[model samples]
Target: MRFIDSHCHLDFDELADNLTKYMSDALASGITQFVVPGISLAQSKSLLAFSQKHPSCHISFGLHPYFLTAHSRDEMALLADLAEQNSEQLVAIGECGIDSQCDDLELQQALFKSHIVLANRLGLPMIVHHRQSHHLIAQAFKQTPPQFGGVIHAFSGSLQQAQYYLKLGFKLGLGGTITYPRAKKTREVVSRLPLSSFVLETDAPSMPVFGFQGQINVPVRLIDIFAQVCQLRNESEDEIAQALYATSCRVFSI
Candidate 1:
């Protein structure tokens, strides 16, 4: 069955330099399309260049919270201008959101709010990144729901949090995080959630699967994540695969 990696950092050096090699492995493993997210302006440019070279690559442009300090007012303006100019080139509006584990909660919130506004304005979905800041992100969704709903990438939240996003018309991105037996809570939530509300991702170059911890994750590992998802859910592999492929397509318009 064919698959799509709904979230990945193919712009990173490790993956970018060896894209042909990893992409070959990924294709062999059934990953046909990749949604590459931009964490900063520079990275977004790299993603654009990469996409130019690979037709299978889709893009998400945003200012990630982790790199908050690196952004400035000029950067934000440029981001908006770039989005307006290259709207057709993007599938979503993020890689942006609050991270409770990080400092400057207020700044993170402000940046996230701006991104949500941008998503709405651009009429595109968003790929949100959340850690311990579910409440804040949920509140943002409640206040200004996205017109083009997106996914909570790498979701490891409770059923309630997952439902909160679903209620806001979002899908949960299942990735390597679910492969670990230690992630019982997330795994259990994945088992119970509606298949329509789920999408598969690998978050490549990070979030490696259980046995490959500390190693750079690759898009091909999306197959292993899909296997864990199949084990968690009651659907057959083909059913799960089709459902996730459709979900990613619907969310990202890929």
Candidate 2:
């Protein structure tokens, strides 16, 4: 039952305060590896430090759409420089992409494009953060596609949208959100999507599952997500786990 959380914010406040204990718990719960995504420059350093301290942890550095205000014109250059200098340490380029929920659609798209270019140049996967803007994100992909395809972290979209990303050679990140009964569309997409195009994630300190309502999410809870996904797809736990592990290895090159 070994597993990998393809996306998480381990540098986030909820997990940062006691990462050692959290990592221990996650290990006990079968999460052997994790990918910590950066939201801004500050978070990127924090993620790097965490990964440096923990052998099982990996890092992805980029500016998130939600934190568009924090980005500067030179930030992309800095990110590219950091990627080149620490290419071995960094696994991918993201928690970055478009989010229409935030007002700055144009700016977010611009920054996302910059990240795509950087990822292509560096030959690293791009972990996309699409929210209420899949169409726009798809359009951006068309303009400047990724060389090393990545996942749509915490996907919540229609089956058609899932197909689009699959056609583009991107994996869909499945997390606790699909555990909720109200996530009908997401569950449908999950059931219909091929196992090869799916990867597990927690997005820890957010997107908590049903039973852990009101509590901060964590990688250990990915087991619950795995079980839910198994039930939805009517597959055995071992089958789902192995498929997801293979999918993650393909996406992250681990």
Pick the lDDT winner: 1
Task: Supply candidate 1's per-residue lDDT for 51.
Answer: 92
- Model 1: clashing residue pairs? none
Model 2, TM vs. native: 0.96
> How much lDDT does each candidate structure score?
0.87, 0.86
Residue-pair clashes, model 2: 0
TM-score of each model, paired residue for residue:
0.97, 0.96
Q: List candidate 2 stretches off by more than 4 Å.
A: none
Q: Model 1 reaches what TM-score against the true structure?
A: 0.97
Candidate 2 residue-wise lDDT, 1-254, digit = tens:
88999998877778778878888998998889998888887778666678878778889889987776754447867877877888778889998988878867888888899999988887889899988889899899999988788999999999999998898889999998899999999999988877887999999989998989998888889989988898888778898899999889878888
RMSD of 1: 1.2
